[model samples]
Target: MKKQIENRSDLQLLVRTFYAKIRADQEIGFFFNETITDWEEHLEKLTDFWDMNVFGTKNYHGNPIIAHNAVDKQFDQQITSNIFGIWLNHWFATIDELFEGENAEILKRRAQKMSTFLFMNIFESRGKV
Candidate 1:
């Protein structure tokens, strides 16, 4: 039986596993390939982010929208809705593999909301407003 994400370790595992897939993906990998020189630090930040998201821990503080906007500028706003779909697919698959419970479900739902919010900011930046 899969366990519900109940602590920081689980969040770390999920963040790491999810990013490993992202780093290997041919399409969305480039967004992170060159920019994130410190993979360990990046993973730590992501762990904190997910930890806060899933567990309501207050350890993460960063403007994700600003960060993704920079990424969009780097690739000329190529992070389309389809790319976000791929990201969410990987996230759901990772969560399903390691977790099964209300918190796990919350993780996916929060990710969906986050993706939409971030993408909307990106679209606005591209004059799609």
Candidate 2:
């Protein structure tokens, strides 16, 4: 019996579950596993981010664009759409495994949009286009 993502606890579950796959994935795990030193703190921040994203709260203030750009530079711009694709795949799989209903669907759509937007920005930040 899955449920809607109606609260912070749910978002926490979603973020934690989704990131587990990301951290374990062979193709993209190194990007996160190496960069994020504090899993507990990072998970809390990500929970806050999803809370603000889904619930219109203001608990999250970190700039994803800057963060991602720095990651790209740190890895010599190795980040690619295939990596984002893997990320999205994990996100969608995690959501489907945990919950259902409008919030579940909304998270999928949001992830899709964010991946595209982030990749574009990452590409532009590389100064290649």
lDDT of each: 0.91, 0.93
lDDT of 2 by residue, 33-120 (tens): 9999999999999998888778988989999999999999999999999999999999999999999999899889988999999999
- How many residue pairs clash in model 2? 0
lDDT of candidate 1 at residue 104, scale 0 to 100: 95
Residue 74's lDDT in candidate 2: 100
Task: Predict model 1's lDDT versus the native.
Answer: 0.91
Q: For candidate 1, report its TM-score.
A: 0.96
lDDT of the structure predicted as candidate 2: 0.93
lDDT of 1 by residue, 13-64 (tens): 9999999999999988888897899999999999989888877888789889
Show model 2 residue runs off by greater than 4 Å: none
Model 2 Cα RMSD, Å? 0.7
Q: Estimated TM-score per prediction?
A: 0.96, 0.97
In model 2, which range of ten residues has the least summed lDDT? 48-57
RMSD, one per candidate, in order: 0.9, 0.7
Worst 10 residues of 1 by lDDT: 50-59
